[model samples]
Target: MENLDIAKFGGTSVGNFDAMTSSYKVVVGNKNSRIVVISACSGVTNLLVELASGKCSDSKINEIIEKLRDIHEQIIIHLENQHELRNYIEGHLKEIKEQTLLANKGTNDQLTDSIVSHGELMSSYLFVALFKHYGTDAQWFDVRSVMRTDSKFSCAKPICEEIKVLAHDKLLPLINDKTIIITQGFIGSNTLGETTTLGRGGSDYTAALLGEALGVATISIWTDVAGVFTTDPRVVKTAKPIPELTYIEAAEMANFGAKVLHPSTMIPAVRQEIPIFVGSSKEPEKGGTWVRPVTKSEPNFRALALRKNQTLIVLSSPVMVGATGFLANVFSVFAKYNHSIDLVSTSEISIAVTIDAGTTTSGKAEISENMLNELRQFCHVKVETGLPLIAIIGNRMSENSGVITKAFDAINKFSVRMICYGASRHNLCFLLKDGDTTEALNELHKQLLED
Candidate 1:
């Protein structure tokens, strides 16, 4: 069987028609049967969101509409077979604009869905049209028709079994024909037939999910960056790209705070043991990061990722020093909020949990009020904000005695509040003051990479 390569282009790659045409050429250069997943043109999603929420003025909406029209027009002008494709895009854009305007006045879920969905709809149409203009055997596939989801608006969960059935029955036929299919990522339809978006940065997830369903050999996420870095270069000057990583390490780094790939995007790919690549759309020739199962390469520290604005909630119960399930009940409240626990440290008298301090500007005292009230029933809960959690991720760190020592020596000046290593020892998460995050990351990266 020929290896199937599924490539997903992010918003930056499809930000404009020139970029779209460039990416198309890159795909053609691969000279292989592949499916391309595309995100909406840049800024369109944000504009749509603002318009749908009635947060922007009519002038702003009109400006966005004009921009969208101009981008499509430019692409059409450059196409060899321009007339038909141009008309199709114009018609679609007009319809999208009208619907967007109509949906602007209301805050209904349907309106939000209609407005936010145009990004992918427009991009999918443009991608297919561009590919056809280049004389490739390309066809546009509407993701909503095949990617089944629940009725949740902002963060809909995929119905995998339903999706698998639909993929086999509806999508596989085109694959067999060797047709290059272009589909929008991040948008799907619920059972009730309402348009729903997968949460933020969901395009990568869409590509992985589709790759898994198709049982593809490889999934390539083509983004602006060359590959995943040892640490965010913006924070650590010496941070370098990691050539490869195990799926477990990549997932842990992503979950801890690596922005290259979404944490949940790896689930399907890992389940199938599919090789995933993170490469540059511009520099396709350059080898990028490869994520797969364990290889002969011994486990080494692959990357450091830091999630900021962390709040540490400490629950101390003098009365429950020897009690069982005391921590379970406290964790239940966090599960209810869907807040991810980044790090945890516990003792006989107290339990400390670290969570992301989402957008709330409230000081630690105010932020802990609800949790403290709940804890007041059995213990004293104290909250500390303005902190950050730095995660050191590696598959072999458990056997490397010097790893933790080196990390501490690197950032010795920073005030670390707590440390929690996962049961599997794949990750070491430490809490530091928010202001010290950058310094700690720089020091750690230098220590790991320089010598």
Candidate 2:
């Protein structure tokens, strides 16, 4: 099949009726826009997550369900097909309430996926109705039908070969120049037909995966931000929107801590070398960022990324003086616990690494004592919390003789916990106390990103 354009809108972009209408304008404006991916209306997923936690009393669950109903009702009541949409949403809300009540108490990953996925499901339904009301030819599409995955439940990985075939069979025939297919993001089905989610902020991943599966010409992501910025705008109010970046730069930015796109979002787009456009739905006229295989601009220092809530793990052992497999053994323990290490630096006797200190989808501390016990069996372990990882992302950073000096000079006053350089040309990563993030970003942005 020929390549088509795909568009995915984030939560805030479709937060309510007005937001959806703004995104709808972006959709109809682009004739090539064949598939429109929607996330749950802003704040809905959190409520669903709370409901699915099974910590709530019957009344609390009822209350959450009612809030969800009200959130959608406000938007539905504005729809021309209010009566039909209300009944449709009410049925799904009822199912959610039933599932939440019956789930084995405590956080069940499988049940969580099943329940939380309704956010996207209901939003897509409402979006379809809204589009129809605006006189656009749109149909609701179940992404799970084509987005087949393994049964990992809360954080499922897609089976790419299966997805390609499924997309051709299920999605190709239905999408055309005039027809707009509205679909859910972040949720998919496993081979056993159980609902699975691609983790939080997976909507971008969903759009990229579909674009890769269907050979899309370009993938447009409409979010609250104008585009990828020099640094987080909140951290540095002067942070400017980046007009263009190479795929590598963008991927590094996402992986390091840019919230605009999911880290995994770059994988599919990279695989197919598909270009992605990110812009704000509210101010579409202001333009956005374009990520391509290669861009005309290539600056040594492109952007700074700050990933918060990082825990620094330091493993010390006398056996590591000249050990060949010590690194492998340490990583093996992380793999056993299904945890990923972000940045690492080593000395003859110790290895220091940074990892996310956030809770797992299962609602447990990611760095559990059990995993620490295993590490302790081999080496002394010291863990530090409240450290955030900062990444200086750029192009040919290693080749830029003065980049490091200039970067460090910018934030020289701050205490640096760990630094990981020479690993990738794209970034220089380090950790700092959480309190220093905003100031560090400000200094770094002024030095590296600004003229």
Per TM-score, the best of the predicted structures is 2
TM-score to native of every candidate shown? 0.85, 0.95
The models' CA-based lDDT, in order, is 0.77, 0.88
- Clashing pairs for model 1 are none
Q: lDDT of candidate 1 vs native?
A: 0.77
Best by lDDT: 2
Candidate 2 segments exceeding 4 Å error:
1-3, 102-104, 357-365
Candidate 1 wrong stretches, greater than 4 Å:
52-54, 57-77, 80-114, 176-178, 309-319, 337-340, 356-387
The TM-score measured for candidate 1 stands at: 0.85
* Candidate RMSDs in order: 4.1, 1.8
In angstroms, give how far residue 383 of model 1 lies from its true place: 5.4
